[model samples]
Target: MFPIRDHNPSGRVPYVTYALLAVNIAVFVVSWFGLRSEYALAEFYYTWGLVPAWLMQGEGYSTLISHMFLHGGWMHLAGNMLFLWIFGDNLEDVLGHLRYFLFYLACGLAAAALQVAGDPGFDGPLIGASGAIAGVLGGYLVLFPRARVDVLLIFIIFFRVFSIPAWVVLGIWFAVQSFNGYSATADGVAYLAHVGGFIAGAVLVLPVLLRRGFWVQNKGKPPHPAAEYLFSPSRIPRVPKR
Candidate 1:
């Protein structure tokens, strides 16, 4: 299951979220052409992607930050951007532009650090904005535990969209990452980095969340309210012919 959208509406416009989405897409387009040539792609990744082994050797430390902006392929970029688009605006609305940007970078750095720790001797290029986006998911869960997220579920030739609590969606995602991290094989993904970024995002937002009285205000309420759209819920057909 993957989230398609959320029911919660932001109290304010999220310009920063839009800007971030634009930047990520622009960067991906530029990098896509580079991937056409193997040497060019390698050179690009060498300079921008995070290499755990190089970092362990006490060099190219900046890649930890740069890698968050680079992605491996079209699907990778699309998935990350889709997530950022869905959950980022509300957080940006709550945290404001500057603070949200800082929070994102910090989470990315922490994620890379965790990945490095997971495999200090492994030599491979790590590229993607997933870690930073994972951070956004973490923050979203803490701030909007009761918010409703619409998840698109696929089963063979069948597809359906269902609404569920944010806590349930994000909680399941974290559990999967932890499980995969522990059971990873030789050529598997770095599930640990995703977990690390998620943890970092949640922890880093604690102070701000506390200061804003989020814990108290959100005690028994959902994050904001259901989104107001041109069409009403009645437009949806009832299941089982109602």
Candidate 2:
């Protein structure tokens, strides 16, 4: 099941979230158009994307941060943006824009580090916003466990949509990522980065959550009308203007 939307919304405009979305798209467009050939594009990614061996060799250390903005392809960019669109604003709402921005960066860095640790010698270049988006998913679960997320499921053209709690959705996601992480075949998905980013988000958000007394609301609550933030047309049915 894939999350299409969530009922919980941000309390204010998520400027940083919007900015990140714009920047990611912009970077991809520039990289896609500027390169003349496939080989050239690959070289670009290798230069900007995080290569664990290169990093461990005391070289190209900047890729840890840059790689998060560089996606491998259109679907990769779309999937990551969709997750960010669904979950990021709420975390930004909870953490405020600046802290949320830093939180995202930290998660990405931790993701790269963990992936490097998992296979320190892997030569392939890792690139995507997924690791950072995974962190947003983790933070969302901690901050809004009870919020209803509408998931779109498809199996052999049998399409279905349903609403479930954030915890359940994120739990399944984490389980799948963890399972794939230990699997025998490497599909080049960077499961370790996903796992690390998710954990980092939860750990980093804990203190802030406690300080803000959100721990008291640990049970989570249903979304209220006032909290509905519309960055775009929500997948959930919108109430008509009276």
Candidate 3:
């Protein structure tokens, strides 16, 4: 299933989110088209992408930040950007632009650290904004647990769009990442990075949530009433007049 959009709307434009997206795209274009050859691309990734083994040796430390802007392929970039677009604006609205940007980078750095901790010897170049984008999802869950999101479910040839609470979708995603990280032996994907980024985002947002009186003022609040803005199930089926 893929999330298409959220029913909850932000009160302000998310400049930081848009800027991040632009940077990621620009970097990808430079790497793909501006670089002289495939070898140059590989070299660029090696220098910037998060490599656990290299980082453990006290080298390439900047990759913690740089890797967040690098992506391995088009689909990888598109997926990460989609998630960010869906969930980031609301967060930026709540946290303000600067704090949100810092929070994002902190989560990315923490994610890389966790990945390194999970596999200190791996040399594979880790590339993608998934870890950072996962961070945004984490914060969104905390701030808008009851917000409705439209998800497109794909089953074989069957497809459907449904509205569900943000908590349900994000919670399931986090659980899956943790389960996969623990169960997998080989390190093809950075499942640990996803888990780490999520944890970081959640933890980092706790102070902000508390200060905003989220728990006190909105305790046990149901999904924001605005969720109805997207779609609501029909109470009565259409009847034909003859």
Candidate 4:
């Protein structure tokens, strides 16, 4: 299951989030079209993507940030952008655009750190925005635990959209990441990076919430214009017009 959208509409246009989407797509296109050869693509990833061994050798330090803008393929890019589109605007709303951008960078750095810590000797290049996007998921869970999200569920041939609380969605996600980080032996995916970025986002959003008085004054308060979240997905039956 994955989320396609959220019911809590952002109060403002998320310029930073859209800008990020543009950059990531543009980079992927360039990597695919300009590089032209598998060897060249691999070389580009080695130089720009986060490689734990390179980092340990006191080089490629910039990959921590640059890596967040790179992706391995179309599905990878689409997935990350979808998450960013759904959740990023909310955090941007709460924190303002500039601070949200910094928060994203900090989370990406934390994610890269944890991925390297998991296997400092691994040489393969790690490329994707998933780690940083996981951080956004973390922050979204904390601030809008009760908000409704539109999750697209796929089970073999069946497909459906389930509208559920953010906590349920993010909680299940965190559990999967943790399980993979600790137990699964998947080679390409950086599970630990996901786990670390999520934790970082949750931790980083706290001070902002406290400073803004949301922690005290609006504790447990939900989205305004409550009607916006009243309906789930399109699959659910709508009321008949009078």
Candidate 5:
């Protein structure tokens, strides 16, 4: 199950969030079209994506930032963008544009560091905005645990949407990431980076959460009015029984 949207709406327009989405999409398009062959794509990833081995050797330092904008595939790009779109605006609203951008970068750097520390010998390129977006999820959970999120669950041919608490969704996500980080095989997913970014984001946003007295006053929910979406009846006319 993955969250499709949240009830929490930001009080201000999230310019930084929109800019991030635009940048990631533009970079993906450039990478998708510019790299005509697999070899060239691989070369591009190696050069721009974070390589743990190179990072450990104090090489390809630029990848630490570049990798956050690069994605492994279309689904990877889509998934990261979706998460960022869902959770990022609220944090940007709270942190403001400049600070939010810095927080995103800091969380991404922390994620890269943890991934390198987790498996320093691995030479594969680590690319995706998941680590950074995971940080956004972390901060959102801290500030809006009680917020309602609509989650879509897919069971092969069956599908359904459920409204659940933000804590439930994000908490389960963190648990899965942590569990996979420890128990899963080499599936090319940087679970350690996700974990590190999440923790970093939670810690980084603590001050804002505290100053707002969100816990004491709002009780972990967003201070602003939560957006409520009501599903209306289908517009299609029903067929009469024969």
Candidate 6:
């Protein structure tokens, strides 16, 4: 299942979120198109993406921040950007532009730290906004547990949309990340980074959640009115199997 959108809407314009999206996209575009050869791309990723071993050896210190904007592939970038687009605005809305940006950076840094802790000797580059985007998902779960999200479920040739609570969506995601982080032996994905980023985001947002009495005042939903979406049925006609 993939979340397409959320009912929780931010009151503000979310300039920071838009800016982040733009920067990430720009970086990906430059790396994807401007770098013509596989070697060049690999070199670029090595320089910008976080390599735990290099970091542990007191090198590539800037990668902790740069790696958040680097992605392994098009799908990787698309997925991370989509998650950020879905969950980022609301958190930015509550935290304000500057605080939310700082929170994102802190969560990214924490994620990198955990990834390094998990595999300090690994040399492969860790690239993607997934770790930081995971943080946004964490914050969204805390602030809007009951907010409805429209998810697209894909099963073989079947496809359908479902409106589920934020807790269910993010909760399942977190559980999967944690499980994979613990069980996987050689998967390239940085599941531990995701876990750490998520925890950091949730912990960082606790103060806001408490100060606003979000649980008491609004039952963990968005402070402002939630957005309502009207989903129209698909126009394509279904074809029977031959």
What local lDDT score does residue 145 receive in model 1, on the 0 to 100 scale? 82
lDDT of 1 by residue, 1-242 (tens): 89888888788788888888888888888888746897888889888888888888888878878888887778888888988988998888888889999999988888888888988887778988888888998988888888888888899998877777889999999999998888874554678889999999898888877898886887724556678544323446667954
**lDDT score for candidate 3 against the true structure:** 0.85
In the range 90-193, model 2's lDDT, one tens digit per residue, is: 88988898999999999998888788899999898999988888899888888788888888888998887777888999999999999998783477799989
Q: In candidate 5, what are the lDDT values of residues 148-207, reduced to their tens digit?
A: 898988999988778889999999999999999998547889999999999999999999
Q: Count residue pairs with overlapping backbones in model 2.
A: 0
Question: Between the candidate structures 3 and 6, which one is better when assessed by TM-score?
Answer: 6
TM-score result, candidate 3: 0.90
Weakest ten-residue segment in model 5 by summed lDDT: 227-236
> What TM value does model 6 have?
0.94
Which candidate model has the greater TM-score, 2 or 6?
A: 6
- lDDT (CA) for every model shown? 0.83, 0.87, 0.85, 0.86, 0.91, 0.90
Q: What TM-score fits each model?
A: 0.91, 0.91, 0.90, 0.91, 0.93, 0.94
User: What residue pairs clash in candidate 2, if any at all?
Assistant: none
Query: Better model by lDDT, 1 or 2?
Result: 2
**Model with the higher lDDT, candidate 4 or 5:** 5
Candidate 2 Cα misplacement greater than 4 A, ranges: 226-242
| Alpha-carbon shift of residue 16 in model 2 (angstroms) | 0.7
Which stretches of model 5 miss by more than 4 angstroms?
230-242
How well does model 5 score by local distance difference test? 0.91
The whole-model C-alpha lDDT of candidate 6 against the native structure comes to: 0.90
